[model samples]
Target: MNVKGLDYTCLTLSIIGAINWGLIGIFRFDLVAFLFGDMSWLSRIIYTLVGLSGLYLISTYGRICQVDDAR
Candidate 1:
């Protein structure tokens, strides 16, 4: 089965955001913030990207999970 390119990109970004949050919970470190500097515009942009990526996942979750489409 071939997944759409956009779906793959969104899924990859979602996984990245999830892992970043997981690290934050366990280590009190935000990787994106650390690299971009907290409170900086770059940091905010990273946060926003992650948030939007998550929202995209929520919106598309059902559509992506249709069993018939997987085959």
Candidate 2:
């Protein structure tokens, strides 16, 4: 149940990203772009950061699952 701090942070960001996507699909709202201003450099930076967080989660989950399978 215990996760590393970085892992936890990445997971939290990933959840935020997912919720934003849900809103976009269901309500046509882009939360990140709205909060940061669409097409602006700041918004783009946030988008990139969120994407990196998701990638981190993917790699972390893969490593954790591999360890569990080895046990």
Candidate 3:
């Protein structure tokens, strides 16, 4: 995927992860687990992907700053 596509995907996953964390903190609920069984392989994979997405999103800060500077 192109950078923009990848960025969007990462952002989306990161947002989902954040929402999951919010639910966990507020209601002791895990949306992934609720949907995919408790700590199942699929749930673990989802968690891992979310984490990687978060890491990928870290680079977005520099990209955003560069874009702003370009204008």
Best lDDT goes to which candidate? 3
lDDT of 2: 0.87
Whole-model Cα lDDT of every candidate shown, in order: 0.79, 0.87, 0.94
Candidates ranked, most accurate by TM-score first? 3, 2, 1
lDDT per residue as tens, model 1, 1-71 = 35577667777877888888899999988888788888699878777877787777785768757865888
Error in Å for residue 45 of model 1: 1.2
**Superposed Cα deviation of residue 53, candidate 3 (Å):** 0.4
Candidate 2 lDDT over residue span 1-71, tens digit each: 45688888888888888999999999999998898898799988877878999887878768989999999
Clashing residue pairs in candidate 2, if any? none
Count of clashes, each model: 0, 0, 0
Ranking by lDDT: 3, 2, 1
Candidate 2 stretches greater than 4 Å from native:
1-3
Q: Each model's TM-score?
A: 0.72, 0.80, 0.92
Model 3 scores a TM of 0.92
TM-score of 1: 0.72
The residue pairs in collision within model 1 are: none
Better of 1 and 2 by lDDT: 2
